[model samples]
Target: MERFSNITEALMNEAKIEIESFDIKDGEKIIAYFSEIPSISGFPYKIILVENSDGIVYARFRQWDTEYDFTRWDNGVYNLDRLRIITDEKILSQTESALLKEYLSQLEKIHLPENINKENVIILDSSLWKFGFILKNKNIDYTWKAATEDINVFVPLINLMREKYLDRI
Candidate 1:
């Protein structure tokens, strides 16, 4: 697992999501957040989730299709022509929000290293998963390359969001 300071910010910008647009109460704190960035095969798509202290979860799912010019395909030249993006947001139900909080609690107890470098492994076209949490006295951000054992602990949470939100995209 790796940590990044601007992963969330960059993702929000890419998805054209405004954090201030969310109706988060003044006293409501952000408890946990998650994002997924897919590879070129799934380019122009991003998923994000933010859960607040008041058991409110906000989801943003974005996907786009691009028209590419491949006239010089043999020479490996690809030009972008047009791009269309579609974005969706949903405020999770009370039951789903509660389940998300429970999953986050379980995630907080898991043992995850600060970093792991697999020098022997070569990963291609894999997704990047990022998670952020506000603990007792500090904020933690964990980024992983593709699916790793350390990050798999929260698969259920990811799956839940994907099934409820991303599946429609």
Candidate 2:
């Protein structure tokens, strides 16, 4: 079982990127959850809506695989290996792309905590918003908890992605 003491710390160490943290009250909260149930297949896939306490919202998506590894970026767009392409005639639809862009736009708006208690690991990429915590009625007390840190938030992220991918099939 892998443990991420904090999201920022795990991402910084695993992805080797630097991030600054602020007060959770000033950070973004999960507003809505979306999963496509018949498009893509296998692995973990998901999309999430996050909004700051000030009422600003955005979305981001993540996909994980156990095979093949590569990273490439053109202009501001990032294409990582073959995971970007689902099938010959079944690629990411315009709606999904637009939705992801909307989420990416808020990447710099939310505040991630400096430290959080975690107990598992999810293979993540260079994406900034890798993990999202689900809340109930905007209440932190209702957040989901997994036995291990990895099983907690990361597993749900993968499940969402899987649902979305299946939707395209």
TM per candidate: 0.59, 0.26
Clashing pairs in 1: none
> In candidate 2, what residue range of length 10 has the lowest lDDT sum?
14-23
Candidate 1 Cα deviation (angstroms), residue 102:
1.0
> Where does model 1 exceed 4 Å of error?
1-31, 51-55, 67-83, 116-119
Q: 65-99, model 2: which lDDT tens digit per residue?
A: 31222233223232222233222112234565455
Worst 10 residues of 1 by lDDT: 65-74
lDDT of each: 0.55, 0.36
lDDT of 2: 0.36
Winner by TM-score: 1
What local lDDT does model 1 show for residue 50?
A: 60
